[model samples]
Target chain A: MTASLIRILPDLARYAAKALTEKKLRSLLTIVGIAIGPMALTAILGVVQGYSNYVINQLEGLGQNLIILVPSANYDMSSSDIAFLRDLPGVKEVTPFYSLRAKAKQGVRDIDIAIYAVDLDVFFHALGKLRLEEGSLPPPGDTASAVIGHYIAFDETGTRYYRVGDVLTLTYYSFKRGRLIQHSISVIVAGVLAEFGNAFFVNPDVTVFLPLDAGPKLLGMKKWSGIIVVADSPAYVENLTKFLREVYGERANVISLIEISKVVASITAAMRFITIAAGSAAFAVAATGIAATMITSVMERTREIGVLKAIGFTDAEIVTSIILEAILMSLLGSAFGIAAGVAAAYALSTRGMVLQGMQVVIRAPPEITLPMIVKTIALTIVIGVLGSLLPAHRAARIPPAEALRYE
Target chain B: MTRDYRAVDGAESTLGQSPGQVPILELRDVHKVYKVGEVKVHALRGLSVRIMPGDFVAVMGPSGSGKSTFLNIAGLLDVPTRGKVFLLGRDVSRLNEVARARIRNRVIGFVFQQFNLIPRLTIYENIEMPLIPRGLPRRERKKLVLKALREAEGDTSWLPKKPLQLSGGQQQRVAIARAIVGRPRLILADEPTGALDRATAARIAALFIRLNREEKLTIVVVTHDPELAHCARKILMIRDGRIVGAEAPQPQRCIAYSRR
Candidate 1:
C-alpha cells in the first residue's frame, strides 16, 4: 500500500491542485476567512504583552522591598493606622508623607515642582534615595525649614536660584471643605539634595522636602497623602503587602513591584481570554467556509468521482486528493496572516503615545515571538484538516454504480 | 514482479488458443438483488459466462435485462449476491473492497457508452489515469499510453486537447485508448456505440476487432446494436435477468471481423 502511494503521489497532488484552481473565487474566499483569525489574535496579543512588560519594568525601577499605600475616598492614613502598620511582624520603618504639586516663586519665574512633607530624622534612614549636598536635614520639629531637590533650583548656568536659609514663597492648590483653594506659604531652605535620574513613584531630583507637621499648619491639610513602608528585605515585601491589604481592605491601595506584577498577571490572563474568544470566533467562521466550499466541490464532482472509482481509483486516494486542497489553502493563509499581523502590530506601536487632557500616556511596541507563530500555524492546519474531512469522506464513500448513473 | 510480467508476456506469443490456460474471467450462478425501499429488485438471476484470452464476446439485452449487472460483477465493480466469480481461475467473489478495486485497476479496463473521459484532463492524461492505480512510473505510463493510442488508431494530435473538445467518435477512441493503456488482461465495455452515429459506430467496432485480434486482448461488450454484436466471436442474448440465446456469426459474414 505504501509503495503504491509513493508512485501515485504526483497524480494525487495534480488532481487536488486542479480542483482548487478550478473554482478560484471560492478557494480565495476560504483562504481569506482563514487569514483573518490568526491576524487579529497575533496583533492584539503582541501589543498587550509589550505594554504589560513596559509597565512592569517601570515599576521595578522605583525600589525593592518598598510598599506604598495611598488613601482613597472616605479613607485617610491617620496616626492610629500608621501606628498599627508600624507594629506589624515584618515592621521596619514607616514614612507617612504629604506629596503636593506646587510652584515656588523665584523672582519673576514661578517654578512648578513637587513638595514632599516627611519626617526629617528617620526619613533619610528608611529610604536611601537622598543625601543632602549642602548643609543638613533640619531638626525634627522645625516645620518651616526645608531641604530642596536639584531641579527646584533648576538653572543651567552657574547661577543658583535657591541656597540654604533662603525664604521661598510656594503656592499650592487643595480642596478645603468641598471648595478648591490656593494657599501660599514661605519656607526656609535648609539644605539641597543631589541631582538624580528619573523615578516612577517619587523623583528626588525635582522636589522639596519639608517637615511632617507643615501640611496641616501651613496648608490647611487634614491628612497625609500616603505612607511608604520600607521592609527589611525583598523577601518580606509580598507578606507585608498581603497583610496590609487585609487590614486596609478597600480603604487604601498597597503598591509594590510584586503587587504590580500580580495585577499585570491578571490583566494578561484577561487579555489571553479576549484573544482566544475573538480568534475562536474567526476560526469557526473559516472552518464553516471550508466545509461549505468542500461540500459544494464534492457534489459538483460526483460524476468525476464515479469515473475515478470505475477506473480503479481507491478510496484512500480519493480522500487524500480532496483533503490536500484544504491543507494547501491553510498554509497559504498562515503565511499571509502572520505577515499582516506583525505588520499591523508595528504600525500601532509607532503611534503609541496618546494625550488625554494634560496627561500623556506612552505604550510599547508589540513582540511577535516564534513560538506564537508556530502554535497559530499548527492550530490552523488542524482546523483545515478537520473542516474538510467530512466532505472528503463523502466523496470517497460514493458507490461507483450510483455515481456512474448520476448526471 | 518482473518474472511474473515476462510469463504473462510469453502467453501472448500467438493469438490462437493455448491449451490448459485459465479463463480471464468466469461467473457461475451469479445473482444480484438491489433494495428499493421495501422492494427487492433482482438485477441478475443465476447468470454464468466465461471469456478466454484473445476472445471477443458481446452480451445483447433490452433495457433492465441485467446486462449492466453482469458487466459490473465481471469488471469487479461489484460482487455476486450468490455463486462464485473467478478471475484467472482465482475465486474473487468474496474479496474485500480494496482487493476488488485493485483488480478493477490492474487486471480489467472499462469503456463506457458515454465515453467517460475526465473533462478537465487532456487526452494524454486521461489515457494515463488507469496506469496511476498500478503505481507505474511516468516514463512507463507514457510508453503504454502512446502504444494504446496507436492501437486504438487515434490521432496523435488529440493528446493536448480535452475530451469535450473532440467529436463523439474521437472521444470514444480516447476512451478505448485509456482502457487499453494499462495493458489489462480483460476489457469490459458497456454500450460501446450507444451514443454514436452509424458511421462512428462502425469505426468503433472496427477498432475493437483490431485490438482483440492484433493485440490479443480479451473483451466483453454489452450492447443491443446488431452491427457491434455481430462482429463478436459469440453473442449472448439476455432477457428478464438471464441469458436466453447464444449466437456465433461466421468471420466472412461480419464486415468488421478479420480474425478466424
Candidate 2:
C-alpha cells in the first residue's frame, strides 16, 4: 500500500500544483491570510521566550542560594538586626548595603545616579564576583575612594564623564530638625567596573559603589537600605529565607531566587496564554478563508471533477487530490511565516525600545528552538486539513452525471 | 444484409463471437427517475440492451429523450433506479461506488460531448488522467499516452498546450485519447461530436471507426447527428428512455467511408 501511495503521490501533487497556479491570485491571497496567524505567533512567542531566558540567566548570575531581605515599610535594618541575620543557621555570609538616590557632577555636567555604600569583602562575597575593566577596587579603609559603574564612567552614547583618579562631586539631601539640608562632598574614582548587561530585576552596571563608612558621613543616615545573604548551599535558601522572614515579621520582605523564579514563571505562562489565544484566533480566520476558497474551487471545477470521475478516478483519489492542494498551500505559507517571524523577532531584539513616559529601555531578542518550529508546522497542517475536509468530501460526493451537465 | 467484419486475427474472435457468447454489456429492465423539487421525472423506463465486444453502435435521440441518461447508465457513471446491469457477465447494478469505479476504470472509457478535459492540465496530462487512478508507473504511463495520442491522430507537439488552448476538434481528439489510454474493453461516448462542425465531426467519427476496427474496442455513441450515427454499424433509436428501433446500414458503405 505504501509503495502504491508513493507512486501516485507525485501525480496528485503535480495536479494540485497545476490547479493552484491556474488561479494564482486566489491561491496567493489565501496563503498570505493563512501565514499571518503563524507569523504573529512565532514573533511574539520568540521574544517572550528570549526575555524569560534573559531574566533566568541574570538570576543565575546573582547566585541560586542568595536571599534578599528588604524593609517592607519605612523601617530600616539596624546593626543588631544585621548581627542577628549573620548568626542565623544556614547563613554563610550577610552583606548590608546603604543605597540612596543622588546626583553626581563632573566638569560642569550632572547626572542622577544611585549611590551604594558597601563593604568590599562582604559585598564581593554575597553578590558574586565583580570584574573591573580598569584600575582596581577601592583600597580597604579608604573612605574617600569610590568605584563607578560602566554607565557612570562612560554614558550610553560612549561619552566619558569620569575616569580613575578623577574627583566626582556628590550631593546628598537629608531632613534634619524638620528642614531639608543638602551635603556636598568629593570622592576619587578608584576603579571602573566592566559592563554588565541588563539583569533580572536590578542593573548593577548603572550604580555607583562607595566605602561602607561613607553612608553616615555623606547622607547623615545610620540605617542600612537592604541586606544580601548567601546561604550555605542552594538547598538551604528556603530555610534561610523562612528564618529571616520570621525574625523580621512584618518589618521586612524576604525573598529567595527560587520564589522569584516561580512568580516569573506564572507571569510568563499568562503572557503565553494571551499570545496563543490571539494567534489561534488568526488561525481560525485563516482556516475559514481556506474553506471558502476550497468550496469555491469545488463549485468552479464541477465539470472538471466530473471528467475526472468519468475517466475512472475513485472518490478517494478525488478527495486526496483536493486535500493535497490545501496541505501544500499551508506548508508553503508556514515556511514564509516562520522566516518573516524570525526576522521580525531579530529586528525587535537588536533595536531596543524605550518605555514611553519612563526611563526604562527594554531589549528582548527571540530565540527560535526546534520545538517551536515543530509546533508551528503542526498547527498549520492541522488547520489546513480541517479547513479542506468538508470541501474535499463535497467534491468527491458530486454525482458524475450531474456534474458533467454543470455549466 | 448482415455481414461480419470481424478481424481475421483470433483477437477479433474474442469479441463479436456467436450469439451464445457473453455480451460485454447487458441492461435488463433498467429504469431511472429524477426528483427535482416536489415533482418526479421518469428519465428511463424499462430499458434493456446488449452490446457485443468490438461492436460500433450509435444511439440517436432528440433532446430530453434520455439518450445521455442511457449512456451514463451503460458507462457505469450512474446506476439504474431499478433492474440489473451486467458488465462482463457480472451483475454490477448492486455494486458500491468503489467497486463500480474500479470496473469503470479497468473496463470502460467515456468521451463526453463537451470534451471534458481538465482546463488547467496540458494535453498530455489530460490524456494521462485514466492511468493515474491505475497507479501505472510514469514511464509506462508515458508510453500508453503517446500511443493513444497517435491513435487519436493528435499531434505530439500539442502535449504541452492546455486544453483551452486547443480548437474544439483538437480538444475532442484529446478527450478521445484520454478515454482510450487505459486500453479499456469498452468506450462510451455521449454526443462526442455535438460541439464540432460537420468536417471535424466526420473526422472524429472516422477516428472512432478506426479505433473500433484496429483496436477491437467496443464502442457505443449517443448523438443527434444522423451523419455521425451512420458511421456506426448499428443505430439504436431512443425515445422517452426506450430503445424504439435498431437498424444496420449497408455494411459496404460504412466500410468504404471508414477506409477514406
Q: Candidate 2: which stretches are off by over 4 Å?
A: A1-3, A72-74, A106-108, A157-161, A351-359, B1-16, B250-260
lDDT of 2 by residue, B68-95 (tens): 8898898888999998899989999989
Best by lDDT: 2
Q: Which stretches of candidate 1 lie over 4 Å from their true place?
A: A2-10, A61-64, A72-97, A101-172, A175-179, A182-223, A230-234, A247-251, A343-362, B1-19, B155-157, B250-260
Cα displacement (Å) at residue B77, model 2: 1.1
True contacts kept of each: 0.58, 0.69
TM-score of chain B taken alone, candidate 2: 0.90
Candidate 1 lDDT over A1-407, as tens digits, reads: 87787678888888788788878888888888899888987888788777777666655554566788998978967888888888887768888888888988655777767888887665677556567889789876788888888867655463588888888788988786799988888889899887754444666767788888887776667788999887887789998888888988999998876677668768887998989898999888878888888999999899889888888888888888888888888887877888898998888877784535423355577978899999989888887888899999999888887787678
The docking category that best describes candidate 1 is medium
Clashes of 2: 0
Model 2's CAPRI class is: medium
